[model samples]
Target chain A: DAGVTQSPTHLIKTRGQQVTLRCSPKSGHDTVSWYQQALGQGPQFIFQYYEEEERQRGNFPDRFSGHQFPNYSSELNVNALLLGDSALYLCASSWGAGTNTEAFFGQGTRLTVV
Target chain B: GENVGLHLPTLSVQEGDNSIINCAYSNSASDYFIWYKQESGKGPQFIIDIRSNMDKRQGQRVTVLLNKTVKHLSLQIAATQPGDSAVYFCAENPNNQAGTALIFGKGTTLSVSS
Candidate 1:
């Protein structure tokens, strides 16, 4: 079974621009979560999607949004990106919504906002 | 707000030695804890996990110990190797809700030397 996969391994955008990142969940998994990891920092929760609906969100602003497809794939969109947005965007997939579930993560998309 | 934190930012050990990474979480209600290893420019990979009900869990060459009384958690890697040199993060599931995101510690950079 394939693990989580993310697209556009790396991206560069200027301030105020919008960017989109994509993720495909692992086989047999139904939940997708997104996180942002700044250099030297741990991954921060951004949001989670299940059943094509956003279930939870972190402290991020409204400019950070996400979508879940019927196939359990996910997309993260950031509008008016700021230099603070430059980080490694990670996508994790889990089998269920419970806290006890194990999660598998993708390689992540590196976003560099100039 | 309950914050998860690490005791150390970096650790170095000989290849044949055991390494321990420590984390402290402020939330007493956290039900699940996870350890993740992230190689350079890569997303975190799940190392091991322990639930609140359990005090310890073991996986292949790794072990996770949880001290609920102090909200302390630890990951022990036996016989550290160069491949184990990476950033290690501990995350806690504050709530089992679908939207509730896992809070992660700052992370400890583990360097295994020959």
Candidate 2:
């Protein structure tokens, strides 16, 4: 089956503008998580969604929000973006909220804020 | 501010040689750890994972060693190849909770040359 898939492989947004990125989870997976990876750095968790609700969140500000649809697909929305928000946004999906379940990731969307 | 961190930022190895990447995590309660390899323009791919109860775990061409005493985690790659060159990240599930997000290290770039 096809693994997680993210849309708009790359995006360009201006400072103070908003942007939305999309993701489709793998088959039979129900949980989706978002992460931000800056250049030369590992990914930082943003939030996690299960059952169409956010179950857990990271240290990011409220400016970064997300939504998970009934189909288990997800979207990440950033409002009033700043240049510092420019980074690679990754989407990962898992079968459940189990502590030991493996996560499958998609090719991330590269956001460039000018 | 407990987090995962890597010892080295970069590693260079020759083809056919074995390579090891090291990481140190500050969360003593973490029960799960994972290693991921990310190539340019792609998302992080799972390599291997180890549980706190197990000292080591082996995959096809990769191995993960966990030293709970020193809070150390390591990834070993057998017969390094040019295609294996990528930024390797060590991640941990903080607090051993079911829905907790993973915290990742700053990653170590692996470079293999013939």
Candidate 3:
């Protein structure tokens, strides 16, 4: 089975520009979450989408937003990107919400903001 | 084939030796913990997980130990091999949050020398 898949493996955007990243969850997974990994740091949770609605969000600013399609594919959009926004964006998929489920991740999209 | 730890605290281990990676979580409410292995340019991959109810769990050659009293978690690798060299991360889920979202730790790079 195909695990999680993300598009635009690598991206370069100028300051104040907007960029969109996409992700397709693994087959049978209905929940998708986004994370950002800075250089030499751990992955930080951004938000999670379930049932086509954002169920939980981290401490990120409003510039970051996401959408989930009926087909289980998701998109992450960052507006007015800042140089600090340059990092690896990771997409993870899980089943239902609970303490028993585990998430599967994709290769991630590398975003570079200049 | 993955090298997620391009720049981080590294642990060098001799081939066939046992390895231990440590993590200390700050959230006392976190009940579920997981360990992930990430290679260069790839998303984190699940290794093992343990809940607050259990202090220890074993899977194949890997084991997870949780000390709820201390809010510490660890991953032990038996007979470490070259393929086991990767950045290891510890993630925690706050009680009811389940697997919806996870908080990750700054990752430790494992280097296996033959």
- Return the lDDT, model 3, position B74: 81
Query: Over the stretch A14-104, how does candidate 1's per-residue lDDT look in tens digits?
Result: 9999999999999999999999999988889999998888888889999999999999999999999999999999999997765458888
Task: Please give the clash total of every predicted structure, in order.
Answer: 1, 0, 4
Pitting candidate 2 against candidate 3, the one with the higher lDDT is 2
Candidate 3 per-residue C-alpha lDDT over B1-114 given as tens digits, one digit per residue, 9 for 90 to 100: 111222236899999999999888777887778899998878899998888889999998999998878777888999999999999998888764534688887889999999
Q: What is the C-alpha RMSD of each candidate to the true structure, in Å?
A: 1.2, 1.1, 4.1
- TM-score of each candidate? 0.97, 0.97, 0.93
Residue-level error in angstroms, candidate 3, position A77: 0.5
In candidate 1, which residue pairs get closer than 3 Å at backbone N, Cα or C atoms, i.e. clash?
A56-B99
Candidate 1 chain A lowest-lDDT run of ten: A95-104
Give per-residue lDDT, candidate 2, residue A18: 97
Error of 1 at B62 (Å): 0.6
**DockQ values per model:** 0.73, 0.75, 0.59
Q: In model 1, which regions exceed 4 Å deviation? A: none
How well is each residue in B23-73 modelled by candidate 2, as lDDT tens digits? Answer: 999989899899999998899998888888899999998999999999999
The DockQ-derived docking category for candidate 3 is: medium
Per-residue C-alpha lDDT of model 1 across residues B1-114, encoded as one tens digit per residue: 438999999999999999999999998988888999999988999999898999999999999999999989999999999999999999989875665478898899999999
